[model samples]
Target: MTVTTRLAAAALLLLSLAGCEGMSRGQQRALSGGAIGAAGGAALGALTGGSALTGALLGGAGGAAIGAITR
Candidate 1:
């Protein structure tokens, strides 16, 4: 895999562990979703000639929605 993918995966793993360790459900979901969204955005951005900042903003907004709706 590429360096970006590797780093994203590592970040996700760490976030997962953090989620499992005493974090409230809302906080965990928000954090996890944000991380996932940012990673996904970065990947998609590179592929679609979009700005990473735009991707990240969109991702974070979507993540917040998902997180809020989950619990």
Candidate 2:
């Protein structure tokens, strides 16, 4: 995988770890979704030769929305 994808995945994994520490359900969902989305977007972007930052932003937004709605 590319640098952007790697970075994003690392970030997502780290955030996921927070959920194990007794964080609020909403907070955990939001964080998890945002992280996953960012990583997914970055991976997709890297494959398509797109901008990592843009992918991250869009992913974060989408994730946030999904997370909020889920809770």
- What does candidate 2 score in Cα RMSD to the true structure? 6.4
Model 2, span 1-71: residue lDDT tens: 99999999999989967656987889778877888888888877778899988888888879877986795
Q: Tell me how far the alpha carbon of residue 44 in candidate 1 is from the true structure, in angstroms, after superposition.
A: 1.0
Q: In model 2, which range of ten residues has the least summed lDDT?
A: 16-25
Which residue runs does candidate 1 get wrong by more than 4 Å? 1-22
Candidate 2 clash pair list: none
All models: lDDT?
0.81, 0.84
Per-model TM-score versus the true fold: 0.62, 0.65
- Candidate 1 per-residue C-alpha lDDT over 1-71 given as tens digits, one digit per residue, 9 for 90 to 100: 99999999999989868657887788788877887887788778878998887888788778867985796
Separate clash counts for every candidate: 0, 0
